[model samples]
Target: MKRCFLWTLTLLVSVVLVVPTQAQEEKFIKRKVAIGRFTNETQYAKGLFYDKENDPMQKQAMDILSSKLAASGKFILLERDDLDVLMAEAGENMQKIGADYIILGSITEFGRKTEGQQKVFSSTKTQTVEAGVSIRLVEASTGLIIYSDEAKGFAETTTKQSLGLGGAAGFDATLSDKAISSALGQLVENIIDKCVDKPWRSYVLSIDDGTYIISGGASQGIAASDSFVVYAKGKTVTNPQTGIKIELPGKKIGTVTVLQTLGDTPETEISLCSYEGEPLDSNKLSNYYISDK
Candidate 1:
């Protein structure tokens, strides 16, 4: 009897630890994303023109944008060519590739200029580059444009050109570099902010006792301690045109607590708790929760 009791205790402890571990693992998962080739939207600018000359400046700009997005740790970037291939393989079902979102952008403008200022005893010269870009985030399934924004900046050269005591004729390389760097940094930051701030929707799988099961996890940036409001079925009405049944409004069920995660699978679990409001219905549930970070 003593040996049996000890074995039972050990098994219980193992089960408890293993269950939570699996649950936590399911909470949040990184999303796979396909960033379509950035189009050059500026008039008169050819597609991929910047890359044609092997311009390091253009390459740097692309690198800055890509690196900033990667740092967010929220999305897996798909190469342009790979996206094409996937689209071909999946055909119309390409949207169902388990991707939560998609990003598209364009470089509208990139131009540099220099100017000079002269005084009786000194002269100053400045070189600046201005870059403009537009970005949009959309739902992979619905192609809904949830977020969009544009950013622009100017970079100045470092070295000042002075031709005379009262005249400056040269460019400042250092100042130009500084200005470019600052603008690039700001553009990248803006893009990251847009991607993470948008509102997204997720589905609820089930509710056992006080626990709730959600469809999103680490891939969707879901974390423990996050709370969500539940909705339940409400009234029903008849459709005037088709004489069909329709739902009126969904009642707010209760709130849920994220207690654990399983993995990046389509179904994940959460802890559900009661709320003062009414429970929401299936239709309402479809509209309420978002997966965005």
Candidate 2:
């Protein structure tokens, strides 16, 4: 009997481990994303300021920004022509691509140069260029501006040697390229860091009058009398280092009690007393989420 019981326990553990492995393999799935055409607003009254042949400096700047954004791994970039074809067919509707989110951006400005003081007796020369860009993310379904940011770049020449005869010399062009690349790379990182996804397993949508709606019902494994903390969707701000942005700290609107559930949607009423002072402002009550605890 002892031998039999030990074997049974061992078998149970083996089954448990094997079952979870199988389940996890089945659950792993990749999320699809699409990057839209990046608009070039860098041109001034004169046309096409960023073309390398016409304007080498601006061309280099545009290339740097585009490449950095592409390297972020946030979305599958769509070519300009392909995107245009899709837009023509779908009339600029993002849902047509079946993407979760879309990135829209414009290069507002770009420049590069160097400037500084020099003392040979008394002489100074400086060259500098400035660039700016704005980027934003929109939800494919609701077209909400979930995230946005602006970044600026300034580059200056950094060379003290000039080529003459067979003498060795270093060029400022290389430094200019590095600066432009670094600034654009940082900007892309910031945008991606700020716009990543935040998923909530449960939610409670409510109004100021103490009435509330709950999701994650019996079908979703939620039960009646289950308590959840309510939160309102708030503003999102960018973090400088990671280039990723996250939602601001939410106000705990109130606590809610699940009164009843119908199918997958649960209807519950909330009490505002749990929050500080009165309930949250009704005007700001756009959406809400539930906590796991």
Candidate 3:
């Protein structure tokens, strides 16, 4: 009896380990993001040589944030540097390639200082740079700001010379990059959390030959045979005091199964899905949307 019980326990352990291995991994859907505008509002901008039209500090902050987001491999970064030109060129088509969220930022504080300690036979010089960054996340669908926060970064370097033999440090220009990178790093996780706080959403683009065409593709973590729930948007009511229109909860209407994907790039990618239940009204497509199960 003891031998049989021990064998059963061993089988249970084996099944427990194997079951986890057979489980499918959760998919990571990529979110589309754009940096709308980054401005320099720091005291350094008041300097005599500062240029309002072309500020290096503002560009630097954007670049740092962009690099961090790209490295995470969880977002499709879009360009908005020439937003006006892009709008004019794309016109109404801009809606197809629009970002899910827009980030507006400002460099609020920036400064550097150097300290030197002198002695009879030895001396030390230290350089420090600090940067403050503020950002706001705007929902592209509603043009409303959803999240806002500020972060600070600091970097410093020290050099010591004994009997004037050690190396001398100059302006330490790289300190600025390090400081800005640090500040943006502190905010990257929060930005990601806020951006993904809600479930991902997509909409039906068109119906072609009975196949439902929808936004997003394999590049956005969508795959063939994957199922998504279809929802009909709820009614909208305007607040009496605030005058802000609020949308009611949505209703689950049906489901869709991915048939295939099209397009070469994420910007133009589209998925072909087959509806599971009764056909939906094509003319009322504006009221329908797709979301994760």
Candidate 4:
């Protein structure tokens, strides 16, 4: 009997490797994202691009970032340039075209430099072009700015000859664009690494005399005695320029732990819990979100 029980236990544990559950199937869902008007904060005028024939420098950077994001396959891309027009054409409401997150950016640097050495016997000329950008992600549901960063990129070319012409190195056609692309590439990588997935969360289903019932199970990755931070959301702010909304995450209301599980999982979530910090003051438990610590 002992041997039979041990064999059955081993088989059950091994089934975990072969049988896929809802938790494994939907641990992370790909999200939709939108890129709004990228701000131009550079000292150079938006109209003063190296190639005046091309669109504004800020527009070019926006297009580059949009293209990269579309190719990533991690997010469903939404068009910001003609959002209202598309909505009117499709006869859809804002809810149908809404994005989970919105991205905003600014061109912080776009300029060129020329420096050289003059000598009786030898002379050299060098030109350097640089571009920098600042980007931030806003949570659409809450209107909160989640992340922000600034990055710079550079491109340089040099010419050297004996008794070189004493002429300044003017702007090259592609130098500025290349530098902007470089900075944008890094920013895209960081966005992919950090913001691709939303954090896992569960809620409080009910509260007893002193115990609590959590709405998570083993299928959702909950384990016995696991610690979690309980948080309630705060006020939201809107961006006047792009109309993107952001919300503050607010402070931790308290902490809780999984004391035991009560039912079958994935469909019927049931986690019993005990307060690890001060207990709930009111019906705030209804609005609380719990995340693993």
Q: Top model by TM-score, which number?
A: 3
The better candidate by lDDT, 1 or 4, is 4
**For residues 1-293, what per-residue lDDT tens digits would candidate 2 score against the true structure?**
99999999999999988987887643111123355545556554355454523455555655665566556544333334365466467653454544445666655776554455545544344566566666677655344567887777666643243232222223345655665565566567655664454332243344435556544444333455656666765677777997655657665666666666665222222222223333555555445544543
Angstrom error at residue 50, model 3: 4.7
Q: Score each candidate by Cα lDDT.
A: 0.57, 0.52, 0.83, 0.70
After superposition, which runs of candidate 2 have C-alpha atoms over 4 Å from their true positions? 1-31, 44-74, 88-92, 113-118, 121-126, 161-183, 199-293
Instruction: Please write out the lDDT profile of model 4 over residues 147-250, one tens digit for every residue.
Output: 89989989888766675544545567777778888899888987876666555455677889778887656644567877777877566677799886555675
Clashes per candidate, residues 3 or more apart or on different chains: 49, 19, 0, 7
lDDT of 1 at 143: 48
Top candidate (lDDT): 3
Error (Å) of candidate 2 at residue 279 is: 38
User: How many residue pairs in model 2 have overlapping backbones?
Assistant: 19
Encode model 3's per-residue lDDT on 1-293: one tens digit a residue.
99999999999999999877767577668998988568888777467887876888887888989999989888999875676565456543445336777788888889999999999999999999999989888766555567888999999999999987998977788898899899889889988988877677888889877899999898889999988989888897888998766768788988989999888887788999898765778988978888885
Which candidate model has the greater lDDT, 3 or 4? Answer: 3
- Span of ten consecutive residues with least summed lDDT in model 1: 266-275
Alpha-carbon deviation at 233 in model 2, angstroms = 18
TM-score against native, each model: 0.48, 0.44, 0.89, 0.51
Model 1, TM vs. native: 0.48
